[model samples]
Target chain A: MSGKVTNGAGGSGDGGDGSEGTPELDAAFFARWMTAAADAVAREADRLTELDSAIGDSDHGGNMRRGFEAVREELGEEVPATPGAVLMTAGRKLVSTVGGASGPLYGTLLRRAGKALGSAERVSREELAGALRTGIDAVAQLGGAVAGDKTMLDALFPAVEALADSGGKDFEAARTAAEQGAEETVPLQARKGRASYLGERSIGHQDPGATSAALLVAALAEADTAVEPEGDADGTGSAQGGSGGSE
Target chain B: MVEAHGGKRVGIVLVSHSKEVADSTARLAAGLAGVPDALVAGAGGLPDGSLGTSEELIVEAARRMDEGAGVALLADLGSAVLTVKTLLAEGDELPEPARLVDAPLIEGAVAAVVTAAGGGDLDTVAAAAEEAYTYRKL
Candidate 1:
């Protein structure tokens, strides 16, 4: 196993069960497969927060590192019984463990997504899309923020839109748009969070939340193809929702 | 200052969002410390570990320091401090000898580190960390 080989464009997709017998996207499989997503997050934790330091807050990587670490710990010794359970518990951990506005917003996204996932092991892209839509709405409700607010929601909204627009057919295409949407937040003034307090000062710097959002999309894309690294940091770095890695 | 870097070892643990970010910070921090300073080790988040939490990162940073006077953990927020504490308690053994300092991350990490490099104890090092939020106070 390559302990530390940096893949700039994301993914070495040979992960998750790509077998024919296990060719099912069932809960057990999804639970098993998401490890790739987990690894991607863990490996990139610090970089994510560093990007945040440039713009909004400098805690994105730190926050996600905490949340995902919890996920890995919870999944320890025993896998989550169902996809929904996995997400719900993860979301709850974020809400309880993480601090800041991101805690609730991201926790809501996961919990909402998990609730929609229910006990089923495997969910099609369509199923996941519905759940993500639920998550997006949940975030909006929880954070009282919307697109163009220069937050993770800005990146998240566009990705979901792209997903729905494509009828949930193209994960890569959707990821690209999500990434683009996240990057678009750079020029936006902060309408929320401490960065919002900074007003015009928040401009020019990349939105940390949006940057993380793009990482999520990149992880999702990695899940689908496990393709070789693309160009240097091709991601838009938006869609950057996080749980603040709080305790 | 105990004046130890020339005679002792130091460890570093930083919490960032990505591996690139972590490495970048580690590289810079390592450079800032100088070769004669202390031994610095780091880890990043990429969803590729036994656990993927920020607290885990802090612990991982702590663990990397095998023979240092103690560790100087730099955090991004108030709660990041809490997570690091939780991680340390779960059998991670952080006595007074082994310290965890939560400083103001972006600029504060460097300042606290610079103070630590001068050979301060955990309390003094941590106090330096507070400077991240109040550099102007100096």
Candidate 2:
């Protein structure tokens, strides 16, 4: 686990080597990232809820939409000066506004990552990847859900792995990996969260949390493309909706 | 605040997926001999009164119920407990010394509330809650 996190951070200084020479991400990038996430959640809210209805409470989509909407409002109200501040503030809002386990779970993810980012004004892609690993670790600790639990970790762990493998330069690759991971949850029996109660009935449905988590990665990739369109034109930006499989 | 019970007692919060479950559990615990004056708050259900837990509601209840003493939370389900822990991790301006008691929900809430109402302090209430795990009804 620590090895993976360290490898993700190893590419922090190689920002200029990418095809587009991506700059260090600042607070503005974080803000845009969150806004994109909010939009994606809104657009996919019903699909998420439908996925949850099969094995869970069918509220994951609504919960995510409400949380991200609150985050967007907070960001618009008072834009934080640093990336950590942006994430921490958004995390706190998610905790307060969103109900259920996902609120706290997702909130802890961002808050832990934000804490790891510390007071840095800007962060290299590798630094962000490392910080995200810290966040995901916190999520696992909080939820007690491992990678095969048919939870968000199903998508998140693989996405983090892809990010590290690419040295954090390939957000699109991470997004694809997350989508594939989410799709992989369709055949898994849930061992955590509300869906675990369904037992074998959960085997055929894609995990709602995992699906929404993929959307979060998609949103981040979209935000990256919006900022550095020229840098990401090398076939990485073309795969818009490869998130296959029915819930 | 004046101590009608003669000393500061640990407060209690009941967290459940169902609002009625939390409220009724608090009521059941409150019926005990020493629990009339103890602060017992019910935090359950979504804002729209649906069947789910809410971290915001739990934090608000914990804040409202805590006096000079600490707060002990008893959750009915795993998600309820997770929600409470997550809210606590968010560093809300809750009173000092709030804890989640890990024991059977109704039994633990009853025991913890009874112990706390008797001025058992934080550790005593927690122990009483844990002791409920050994209670056999057979």
Q: How high is the lDDT of residue A160 in model 1? A: 80
Per-model lDDT: 0.60, 0.83
Task: Give the distance in Å from residue A214's predicted Cα in candidate 1 to where it truly belongs.
Answer: 1.7
Q: Pick the candidate with the highest TM-score.
A: 2
TM-score for chain B of all predictions: 0.68, 0.89
C-alpha lDDT (0 to 100) for residue A73 of candidate 1: 70
Interface RMSD of 1: 7.4
Model 1 Cα lDDT, one tens digit per residue, B1-138: 555445444455665544456556666765775633244544444335322234445455676664556666665432344344434432334423555564555465566566666666556666766766666654
Model 1 TM-score on a 0 to 1 scale: 0.52
* Stretches of candidate 2 exceeding 4 Å from the true structure: A1-23, A228-247, B1-6
**What's model 2's TM-score?**
0.87
